[model samples]
Structures are given as structure tokens and as C-alpha cells.
Target: MISAASRAMLAALALAAATVTAWAQDFPNRPLTIVLPYPPGASTEQVARMVQPILQERLKQPVVIENKPGGNGSIGTMFVARSPADGYTILLTTNALMTIVPHVQAMPFDPLKDFVPLTTAIRGILGLAVNPNVPAKNMAEFIAYAKANPKKVHYGTAGIGSPQHMAGLLLNREAGIDLVHVPYKGGAPAANDAMGGHIQAVIATISSTLGQHSAGRLRIIGIGEKERFAGQPDIQAIAETVPGFEATSWLAFYAPAGTPKAVVDVLNRELVFALSSPDVKKKLFDLGLPAVADKPEELDKRTREDHKLWGDIARQMNVRAE
Candidate 1:
């Protein structure tokens, strides 16, 4: 039953499969690039630099970091989305790009559909801090103060529709306070303004606020985790006072959709290995970001969960992207 034409077709199919397997096995013939959606000094960039060396070592190839910050991280993210799905160009960014921004602004790419989740590297522990001049020692006091002096209780965030901003939005809803949002170009500016008392409060990662809090220029009121952040044990969780109030940002990696499964596996394995190093873990802890290198499936699950959670909040609060 084997005609000449059928034999040719079978031979071609077998050769194609063999070619794909060989290609996968011979991946990364050149340098790999990790695209950062925010400018340098942003949390994602910090973590990427931390792991870059480890990745280069594991892959035996140069690992480059490219920053393309804009449109609330959408610009760089979309750039990666449109890149070749050959696994050379990867995306190192925060969950906000996929989880929160889409809910507020129109996007050029569908985050949920355009990228393949690689892994989440770290969880940035956020905290609520107030200027020393504010008459608030804790979340309750701050909420009460904000209620009484709504106009004076403005809070600074990394930018409009950022994770910091979303946390502030959630706090406003749960604590029944009206803290005005003052968006800045980045966390550094926001923290600086908060330290100078130009802004009354700031809800940013503990690392961003730790120096000011330690110098007594800013008073850390509460953390934004279910439990106290490890780096700042004295500060209480915002949930302690405003029950069910918890929000945090995380850094994760992604590759363009249709990237071969074999390539994804290599990246994920190396990433998990890099983050599992003791030195890397300690560095992350010192920076107030806990290492959380979970499986790619877990990142996908969390992305979906957070996307829905923040989407609901965005709709309720009528948040619009600037």
C-alpha cells in the first residue's frame, strides 16, 4: 500500500521532526537579551542585573539588558510581544504590566495572549510610610487623619496605574480614606518627594522607603503583606488594621508567544537555578524583595489571579491611566 508519493511524504515528515529536535538542542548560538519595560533603577531592572551573571554563566552566552520604558511599561512589553519567537529576546518585568495596566489603559498587545510566562523571580514587599510631620503612627491613625484632612493626605506613587498607585487605590477603598495621588516619574522621585514632605505619604517597596524611614525623615506606618515584611519586622501589616488589605509587586520573566517549549524549559530551569543561589537570595532579602522562583505554571496562575483582582478594583475605583 506504499506508493512512491506516500513514501516521499513520510520521509519529509521525519526529516522535519529531526530538524526541529536538532534546532532545539542547538539553541542560543548567540547572545540573549532581556528587555526591561521600565527605566534603570526600577525594581525589575535591579533584579535583572542581579541575575544576569548567573544566566550568562549557565547559557554560556552574553546576556544583555535593554530598557524601553514608556506607556506604563506597555511599550517595552509590546516590543517583546512582536519580537521573533525564537527565544533570543526575553522580557524581564513586573506583574503590573500584565495585571494592572491593561485594566486602566488601552494596550497595543494582549498581554494574556502575547507572551509565555517564564517564572517569577522575586516579590517586592511594599510598605505604607508617612512624612514625619503627619500625625499618624499606624494605619488606623493615618486613615483617621486622612479622613479628617483629605486634602492634606496626598500619597506619592511611582506613576499613575503602577503597582504602587494600585496599592494606594486599594488602601483608599478599604480604609475609607481619601488620599490624593501624586504620580512621579519613578519610585526614586516619589520617595524623595515623600521624604521632603512635599507629599504626605508613599506606598512603595520597603527598599525604596527603608533609608528615609531609618533616618527618621519618614515614618513607616504599615506594610502591605499578610504578615510583616522580613526586612522591617517592627512595622505591622496594613491588614492588621484594615482587614483584608494586602498588595505587593513582583518581578517575572516572559518570552514571546509561540516560542518553542524547549526554549522555555531551558530559560525556566536556568532562572530557577539562578534565583536559588544563597548569595542571590541574601541580596534579594537585603533589598526587601523575597526570592520566589516558582514554576512557570504558577506564574501563569498568579498572573491570571492578579489580573482579575486588580481589574475588579480598577473598575470599582474608576481608575484611568495617565
Candidate 2:
């Protein structure tokens, strides 16, 4: 026998549970938005556009992409962090905002607390490319050249505190060279400057410099991966020349924290399917970003590990947001 108040409390709990279940079941009955925290021409936007139609088809709703670029990706990320947790709005961004940015800048939202990891879509390859005029043919030669020149060797990157910047710093520490960092508004500009001989070298995503490298305008000497990238085996890993050196980037999906688990499951299922498609895989590979459709748990684990890894590196390198 229960008191009247106790009975009412139990009934209320049951009603709440039923309501949540119904909400999850009816999710995305309206339009869904994928928020990208970068400019229109970014690789992140390209990837989002690639999957938008597939996600819409599978979810039986219109999926829209919204770009909110600023503060090195924090502006749009905060927007999603504060969005309703109904799974209507999700974030498609790089690991930099979560793992690297917070270590250097003051963030408005807590990365580990404000969002839930969905899955990683692709792995971006960052490469170190030099002007064709540079006499360095490979990583070893480039290191020697930089060592000989000291601070005279200048390397450009997307911006200060960016992954490319960190890679350049790591190379400086590992190779014992003093390559001055020239921060640019974006990777394309940085690569363009390098090609024009304005900068001796540029650390940026391969997609931005691959064409120039192939055209002999800029020469990609090494990549920031533990092993050679399969698509371009000729380019050696910077790790090969400087043991234990690696600085890679990836793009992943996330929803605001407290989004229902059932809704997350639905999203994960469709995302995995779209990413696993052969068409998508080939397109991503051609763009120098290989598809990686790992499970949500795997993404979560990777995020946590990278957060710690980058934090340690930032402390060691004294990296601060510019």
C-alpha cells in the first residue's frame, strides 16, 4: 500500500519515460541541421555536403548544412553546445576544436562536457611542403637545410595554434632546427605563399598543396603521420626522419550533451552507412582524407586520448592561442 503522493510520483515517472520514448521515435520529423564551424570552402564543409543527401534520404527528412566560422571554430561549436538536445542540430567539425584549441585558447563551453561524440568521418593528412626552389628533396635534406639556415628558414601555416602550427613546432623540437612560423589566414594562402617563394615551407593539409606538388610548383617533402599515407607512398612520413614525430588531424560528428541515446543511435546508424559507401570513400580518398567510420564509443575514446595528448604537447611547447 502506497501513500497518494508516492503513487502520483510513480505515475509521473512513467509518463515522463513514455514521453521521452515518443520524442525519440518521432525525431527529425522536421528539418535537421549539420553545423560546420568553418568557412564554405573548407574540407569540413565539403565532407558535410557529400553526406547531406545520404543522411536526408536515410532519416526521411531534409538535412541542412550551416556554416558558422569564427574564433578558430569555437563560435559555431558553442552554438551547437547550447542548442536543444533533441538531436535536430548536430556538429560536424575537426578534432582540433575539441582536443587542441582548448589547450591554447579560452573556450566558452567545456568540450568534454558540452557535447557527445558521434563518430569520426575522415582522417585529414597534414604535409610539409617547400617551394620548388628549396634544395631539400626529402625530410632529411629539409632538416639539414633548416639546421644550416637556423631562423632564416620560415614555414607558414593556416594560423597560430592550428594543427599545422603544432606540427611545425614539433618538427622544430624534434629536428633541433629553428624554422620561423609565419601564420596565415588559411592553408590555401599559406601554400600559395610558399609556392610563390614568399615562405620557404608550409605545413598544411595535403589537399591544399597536392595539385601544386604534382605540378612541381611546391614539393611535399614529408607528412605528419606515423607511416606513409597509402594514397601517396612516395611522400615519406616526417616520423621516418624524426623518430616519434606525428601530428595528424581528423573530422568527427557530435551532438549537444543530454541528447537522447535512442536518437543518437539512429544518427550513428545512418552516418556509418553513408560513410561506408564506396562512392563516399573514393571521393574522400581522392581529396586526401580517407574515410573512417568508427563507432561512437571509438570516437569518444579517441577524443579523450587526443585531448590529453595535445594538452601535454601544448604544455611542453608553451603553445598559446594567438
Note the residue pairs that clash in candidate 2: none
How do the residues 264-298 of candidate 2 rate in per-residue lDDT, one tens digit apiece?
A: 98888889899989999999999899999888899
Superposed Cα RMSD, model 1: 2.1
Tens digit of per-residue lDDT, candidate 1, span 170-266: 9888888788999987788888898888888888888888888999988989988999876778999999998988898999999999988888988
The backbone clash count of each candidate, in order, is 0, 0
User: If scored against the real structure, what TM-score would every candidate get?
Assistant: 0.93, 0.95
CA lDDT, candidate 1, residue 268: 91
Best by TM-score: 2
Worst 10-residue lDDT window for candidate 1 reads 38-47
What TM-score does candidate 2 reach?
0.95
Instruction: Quote the positional error of residue 207 for candidate 1 in Å.
Output: 1.3
- Candidate 1 residue pairs in clash (backbone atoms < 3 Å): none
